[model samples]
Target: MRLRNIPGAKESLQQHPSIIIPNPSENKGNWKAVFGNDNPIHVEVGTGKGQFLIGMSKLHPNVNFIGIEKYDSVLVRALEQAKEEERPNLKFLNEDVEDILTFFEKAEIERIFINFTDPWPKNRHEKRRLTYKGFLDMYKQILVKNGEIHFKTDNQGLFEYSLESFSGYGMTLHHVSLDLHRSGMEGNVMTEYEQKFSRKGMRIYRCEAKFRA
Candidate 1:
């Protein structure tokens, strides 16, 4: 993904203190205080343009939603879209995936969503993939016991690789779909990339994996 630097994007995000969490590391374990409630927190990692997070926030009003995106340019687009709505349960985080553990404590997050993350197709970059064991281990640290990961992608290679990664890590898989759109699955939320790829006749793969004790 070639990203064009958006001038003042970082400045804009900083200005919206209510929508964007400033110094997320400080509020690590006390996320409920940030939302002013004890409702279960669900996060979407690599939330490009925030379509899925925004939609989920509105649909599930009782659940708090956080969208984490690393790039300022791409995150700014999500911020702009979220600004139009008055969602008290929705927030955005401009942070790298590698520092994820620093922003949350054990059993802090109830659910995680990974939508169309970068495949990092090179074998040498396998560890960098979001579904890689390294990343999964990081997720396990913050996620509650039995916390679930919902993942979807259009890349077959990444999907296959992720299936193995999740299974190898002892995550029970369910609702595995090779062609999500045609699978007639209900309550499916489409991300920006999911919509774009599905329109071009690309197959979307989806699965739900839960860490078992």
Candidate 2:
């Protein structure tokens, strides 16, 4: 997906102190202070256009939701959408996932959502996949014991690879679905890409994996 450059995206994000956190790394280990309550923190990596995070924040007001997106152009759209809704429990992070550890402390996050992440199809780029062991290890360091990663994708190859990766890492998988929309799962919030792809007859795969510590 080609993203058109959104002028002043960075500036807009900086201006919205209530919605986007500036220099989030400085708040590492003290995220609960930022939220002003001891609520379970759930992060959505690669939150495109912010639909899932926004919807989840609205549905679960007791849980704090953070949307992380790297591209300023893509994140700007989400920031704009968030402006329309007043969700105190929701926040956005305009940063790369590679520095994720620097933004939170160990066992700081309770859950992670990887919705329609980039497949990184090339075999050489397998390590870059969000479900790769390296990333999972990082997640384990930040996630509380029994915390789970909820993943969804329309790419079968990526889904298969992720299942193998998760299993190889000794993570337990549950609620595996080849067609999430047809699975009749309750409380599933559809992302923007999920809605688009499922509308075009694409098979949506989903699963939840946890590293029992």
Candidate 3:
């Protein structure tokens, strides 16, 4: 699918180097240097408009956060929100997840967040799903020992598929909620899509999975 170019989006991202790191690959394994501290790094893959990541960053000042978005146009919106306050531990990556290994070394990440990603419900596009085994393997390599993946989605099929995929990949699941809003789970941050969907009375499924050591 072709994405419509947003006017000045590219220029906006370049203007905010503090919020969006320029040339993220240069930092590589030494991500601590970027934030000037050794706090554990937690990454949010596919951070659409950065609602949840930004909220989490505010809620946890001690933990460093990186939000990865594929497009500069969409990422600019996240940077806009990030700039609203002083978030020294928060940063944005205008890059693709397929090249995630290039930006971080083995066991460099403490945790990962996958919120309201595309389900790719078609069977043929199963591999494109974020929870697919291939993506999980990539995540495992970069995550620290017993690092957790916190995932939330509005699709039932994808939730079930992800559960099976995680189990097949030897990942342990915890806090699996079929309806997240009413589950009374604390510290729940809502993404843009999640907020919209939940307002319409749609069910939200969430789970935390950890890779085997």
Please name the candidate that would achieve the greatest TM-score relative to the true structure: 1
Model 2 per-residue lDDT tens digits across residues 1-213: 677998888888888977889899999999989999999999999998999999999889999999999998888888888999988899999899988999999999999999999999999999899999999989999999999999999999999999999999999999999999899999999999999998999999999998888
List the global CA lDDT of all models: 0.94, 0.93, 0.92
In terms of lDDT, the best-performing candidate is: 1
Location of the lowest summed lDDT over 10 successive residues in candidate 1:
78-87
Q: Rank the candidates by TM-score, best first.
A: 1, 2, 3
Residue 180, candidate 2: alpha-carbon lDDT: 92
Candidate 2 regions with alpha-carbon error over 4 angstroms: none
TM-score (all chains, Cα) for each model:
0.98, 0.98, 0.97
lDDT of 1 by residue, 11-114 (tens): 99999989989999999999999999999999999998999988998889999999999899999999999999879999999999899999999999999999
- The alpha-carbon deviation from the true structure for residue 146 of candidate 1, after best TM-score superposition, in angstroms, is 0.6
**Considering lDDT, which of the candidate structures 2 and 3 is the better prediction for this target?**
2
Lowest summed lDDT across 10 adjacent residues in model 2 is found at 1-10
Steric collisions counted per model:
0, 0, 0
**Model 1, position 148: C-alpha lDDT score:** 96
